[model samples]
Target: MSDRDASTPRVILARHGETEWTINGRYTGITELELTPRGEQQVLSTGKLLVGTGKLIDPVQLERVFVSPRRRARKTFELLFGTESELAALNKVEFTEDIAEWGYGAYEGLFGEEIVARRNEQGLDTERPWDIWKDGCEGGESSEQATQRLDSLINRIRDIQRPYMHGEKPVDIVLVAHGHILRAFAKRWLGVPMGSPLAMMLPPGAIGVLSYEEHDINAPAFLVGIALPLEEK
Candidate 1:
């Protein structure tokens, strides 16, 4: 257990690059999709901005990297981190289903409008708009289920950093996953309920930072920064 600085350990949540379904605004949960050409380029650009010496994220300070089991997320990690040789030399990367995209289930591969129309036809509570956070997928995880799993993951992360909590060493972790799940993770990090009306938009390949306040490990965590695409900047 290395000694960590008083600063709360940080977690960098990176959403995977664009995919065919992402470009089309379709539900791609649990679907194996590759990054588009533009997606690949954009993520590469982000890597230059966020990773490396004096960058927002210092690669040498990273303790561990967690990635979604999905190919898109894995590919994004590779692109942002380094080449094969470079990645192999750094901290080991672990792929976990815990960070995978939300399970869309019956609503998989459908556009937002399509999901609402289908739900109406099936008479599955169509009185209101289809809000995944509130309604969840008919055959997928509910808000409770998602929150439970994410909370479990968060606890694991905190445990990993416990040994380094009071030291000067950096104990940062990186999560490469999907948009919805990462967004939800950020909210849960702040101890916010899943049903809360928190409007957070993480574009493809964007990086969102989470850390504690006042350099206190036990302090409430909050978003420190969100790195947008180079073009957007």
Candidate 2:
């Protein structure tokens, strides 16, 4: 069922490491936060794993790289691939808010346990059967807004792919971003309905590969694999 030929491009998604909020299950949005010590190790392990995978972008063949504007994501890109001169000499990396994490609004610092308790006390289990992308953020983004943002970002990637089929150079694109947004991107890539919350669930410091096979322009994107190399012992 391979639709991609040799012409279609591949996308590698890198999820940023654990911030304090992530470790505590807080709904982190665009708010900038540094990775915790554990988070830093997780990211380092990812970089080490990537190097071992032999997926290093060959300076000659490497095309473009993109990172979410959030500090955690941006730092992951810089650390994993090396800073400005390092990546630029090997490949081009750009920062774009389009790939930022889901905007959580009022839920920014609350974990699942906290959310559940708060809802319970209010006599309304607002988060029951909770699906992040399908829930309202109160002072933040609605599920609709999250879906729309993912859709727009995916569309941007698609536009880049169009020209790639007609002899334009094939670009190996890498995106450094958050777990929730990347999961949504995976859904959109495969044409899955936006509400399918389980399309993909990535852990902090995970690496996911999305590639086309057999050059089928209409073929759905595939999730080659998602690896979290630095989980706790």
Highest-lDDT candidate:
1
Ten contiguous residues with the weakest lDDT in model 1 = 224-233
Q: lDDT of all the models against the reference? A: 0.82, 0.71
TM-score against truth, every candidate:
0.88, 0.81
- Tens-place lDDT per residue, model 2, 85-187, is 4666644767887788777776678877777676567676554655556666667777677677777877777777756754368566788899888888788
Error of 2 at 6 (Å): 6.5
lDDT (Cα, tens digit) per residue for candidate 1, span 53-156: 65667776677888999999989988997766254566457789888899889889999889889988888775767678887888998988899999999998
Candidate 2's TM-score reads: 0.81
Off by over 4 Å in 2: 2-7, 51-60, 86-91, 120-128, 165-168, 225-233
Residue 13, model 1: Cα distance from true site in angstroms: 0.9
